[model samples]
Target: MSEVAVRMRLLQQSFDAFDESAAARLGLNRTDLRCLDLILAKDPMAAGELTTAAKLSPAATTTAIDRLERAGFVTRSRDAANRRRVLVAATEAARAAEREVYGPLGEAGTSALRRYGEEQLAVIIDFLETARRVQEEQTARLKKLPVRE
Candidate 1:
């Protein structure tokens, strides 16, 4: 692998470690925290949508939601436009956690980005988008493979 590939792997590992630590600090498992992140990213999102986004089985998603709700991180309600549908939302506690945990990280990221010019920033954005798309495609490909013993 090239140097960039090695660096990317390290970056992914760092992110995973950070996520685990953050989740632990909030008294949640990684899966539960991930579900909360999905809900926070899209407030009032359908439970089904969250399940898909989190790539969890329906039962697992339900359990995550239950845990988050019990922990005061999330709430479930009927969708206003579709009463039959259930929507998930982050609670104030969850928002506060996000602000407390990630606010400084966001500020540091923004400060780092400030060193780049507009064209450099555009390139960075394109690279990030392409990388994300490839990761999504790879995830789908993995999901299609037969389960191993």
Candidate 2:
């Protein structure tokens, strides 16, 4: 692999480690942290949308939301435009915590990206999107794989 590819892999691994530590610090399992992240990333996101993004069943998603709710990390509401639909929104507390933990990293990323021109940034975006799709496919395949005894 090229140096860029190797650097990307290392960066990804480092980010995963950061998530693991953050989850532990927040007293959440990785899945719960991931669910919380989805909510925080997309404020006022629909409940079903979160389930789809998290690849969780409706029941499991409910449980995860309940946990976050109990922790005052998120709130659930009936959508005004669609009363039948539930919406998930991150609490100020949660968003504040996220900012506290991730703001510096986000700033650093912005600084790094400033060095790239539009064309280079487009290539980076394309690479990231393609990689994300591949990871999604692989995760789904792994979910369907039979366990060995």
By TM-score, who's the top model here?
A: 1
TM-score of candidate 1 versus the correct structure, residues matched by position:
0.93
lDDT of 2 by residue, 78-115 (tens): 99999999999999989887987788879999998999
The estimated TM-scores of all candidates read 0.93, 0.80
Q: How far does residue 6 in candidate 2 sit from its true spot (Å)?
A: 3.9
- Which residue pairs of candidate 1 clash? none
| Per-candidate local distance difference test | 0.93, 0.91
* Residue ranges of candidate 1 with Cα displaced over 4 Å: none
Judged by whole-model lDDT over C-alpha atoms, candidate 2 comes out at 0.91
- The 10 consecutive residues of candidate 2 with the worst lDDT sum are 96-105
Give the lDDT of residue 111 in candidate 2. 99
Clash totals for all models, in order?
0, 0
